[model samples]
Target: TQVTCRNSLKNPLWSLIEIPIISSVTCQTVTGLIFFQNDFCARILLLELKWCVLCLLLNEAELQQRSPPSMISLAGGSPNPNTFPFLSASIQVKNGRTVTFDEATMKRALQYSASNGIPELVTWMKNLQKNLHNPPTASYSPEKGQMDMCVTTGSQEGLCKVFEMLVNPGDNVLLDAPTYSGTLTALRPLGCNLINVPSDQHGMIPAALKKVLSRWDPSEVHKPDSTAPKILYTIPNGGNPTGASMTAERKKEVYELARLYDMLIIEDDPYYFLQFEKVQRWLTSSVSVPFPWAPTFLSMDVDGRIIRTDSFSKILSSGLRIGFVTGPKPLVDRVVLHIQASTMHTSSFTQLMVSQLLHSWGQEGFLQHIDRVIEFYRKQRDAMLSSADKWLKDVAEWHSPSAGMFLWMKLRGVADTQQLIVEKALEKEVLLVPGGVFMINSSDPCPYVRAAFSLSTPEQIDEAFKRLSLLIKDAL
Candidate 1:
């Protein structure tokens, strides 16, 4: 499995001077020999090949390997902006402009920081908390055992640290089916028993949860808990694979359920800022708008059971890898112990950059930037949907996403999207993610595939779809 390249040492001029100069050398045939080590003294054979008619072809030339071209990446969960270009100004910067970081802001944002998070960032986060969760901010008060906020690499890290603290090996945890794949991947090594609850467009069905919880017995082999679940995970805004957003009423219902059962809710909402509904944007702008920026599980918590995980990746750059978690101090304190042992603290530089960016943009500017991003995705979604309607209306069906950057297309009458994607579409140079990749249980067949419009151009989008349509047709 090794490739060797041989380069000749003599220069062309030197070779001509030493020997008779030749105009060109014709290679009648190129032979590749293969040797196999077997029972006998290593058998050798001539490999099969074909050579074309005489023609002068360049050879022994300097060939450099280049990285693959930046692709029409219509596979990951992302937003496309061709439909709505919100940041018309930002993307049109002049040359030679450098991005600068705030030094004073960095020092201020650091300063040993509180156990929960830096005091100022904590204050900023708490203000967001108040906006999202309407609990008396006074109750969290000057010194309630609540961890105001703890910054982590991102929500995924926060979820991991929380799981490490709350779950012992063999303990039971409940996850929604087709949950965020990262959550399952992270928790697998912890050896906790996972139970997946069934869900629909509104998110984890209350009736299904009630049934699952009622049937649970502590002494049973696969039972989760004698009391209640250690944690209940959900992505309320623009959930990963399903793209379901939980309504305020549903949030209240889930909150009450969590309160009655004494379980914590891990609200992993990276896409909170990316809410797609034009109405939600107007609501966010209204004078009556409240904390955490929108109606969140944390906002509705009369009891502090919601461990809210928020990220800057969707709004800011993903490379920053910055996010924060807010919850009761005792729980956050335990999580900090894990953070102290693991990553210590998220990069102060990263936190400061985001803080400074926010300071410069102000609340209005921040909202404007988010709108720009959302609008971009909105356009991308429309383009993809339009293409689907024209090319795949009968072959595929999908729900128009209310938020986030994916189209969860269920191919009509196609039982296995995985095979179609892996064995067929990929061979034709059109890539798509099969639904099975996002499932908690891999054995299950999902008649769905995820398409992303965040990075592909309109023409490329059409071509990719055409290729996909042909592949699906061939499958039928």
Candidate 2:
């Protein structure tokens, strides 16, 4: 007897062939007939076969998950939970004010929480972004292209996730020349075609960007078939390495170009609060004044094209690994998805700490804290600039940065600073980051070097510049 089966073959577990039963009387045939006659045995057989097929399918699906035991992984996303040992913490602020987290807050931090972040902390960040950037309009709904925020381990992590969400292999990415080395490190492995837009003292030059975009020739690129650059990655305020902040007018021009080119702008402005002019005035005068902040790309993002990443690393503590991304809800949602699958969320304890600090400070207090920080760094900037003027004025030229940490110097007569740094600067006990490392084409000759004054003492700044001057003169 033949049993008719309507096997669509769409499900791989089941076979399309029919089974025929015969009345022949062999021992094996008799056993088979008995098993076939029992519905339970037949069902068991089908289930076992399905299980075997499922195993095979799963094995085929995840080749990377089945990596050999000998394969060592350097690509880990989650930090070891053991490192965080604080059950509770208290921070003292100005005016004898102390903010402390109790057991309840500690418990919430120790245990798992929402993927987006701690809700209260997220609200604080959203308010901060709103007050700081004053984005032309706002929305929380992704469908409406409303702005939203997501907490990240750091701004660097947000940057990595953004690149992952937006860039495919061989996609074009626009970057300000002398870009952050960290940005290059995050994007290089993705195989992106990087186009460098030249920058001046006021960050990315809008006219240069316009010319590059208008005359963009795909044939000139290594990958002609790649899509046109849809993203511009910039460090708008006190740009890393270059230490050039975009003026409000420059930001407006760049924003217009982004609109004209239909591109998304990634504004990684970690040093926004560190702008110095108003802080200098407040420090010098007897009366305190509000800190003046430059207009951010987000302020001009009428079309929701700017994704701004900010960090506590510069303002607060670097070890906290706390930062936030503010942008259109859809893009932020993607970042949250990536976070959920990877680090899960930024540390709840860290978020709680930051939130408590902000709450105690209120808007005025927060502004005051940043003003003090800016004043501290402004002196350092002054020290570095003074040393440069005294020691190497004839040998090197640089624009005194209005914001951020580094002093970018163009060394006269040197073709590449990398060799000088390796052979001479280190030998002289003075160290600096070669400007070539920050260039889009690392092989290109760069006469520049970046000197950071954020951590060094005034004496160290003067001594380092003196040594660097000697090295430059020797090379010449």
Write down the lDDT of every candidate, Cα atoms only. Answer: 0.62, 0.74
Q: Against the true structure, candidate 2 has what lDDT?
A: 0.74
The clash number for model 2 is: 1
Segments in model 1 whose C-alpha atoms lie over 4 Å from true places: 1-116, 136-138, 141-147, 217-228, 279-294
Cα shift from native, residue 95, model 1 (Å): 14
In angstroms, the error of model 2 at 109 is 1.8
Please identify model 2 stretches exceeding 4 Å from their true place.
1-87, 93-95, 139-141, 216-226, 279-289
The Cα error of candidate 1 at residue 116, in Å, is 4.4
lDDT of 1 by residue, 257-298 (tens): 765555668888887877777543222445533222347887
Can you write out model 2's per-residue Cα lDDT over 139-190, one digit (the tens) per residue? 4333334688888998999999888767666667899998999999999998
Scanning candidate 1 in windows of ten residues, the lowest lDDT window is 40-49
Strongest candidate by TM-score = 2
Candidate 1 global CA lDDT score: 0.62
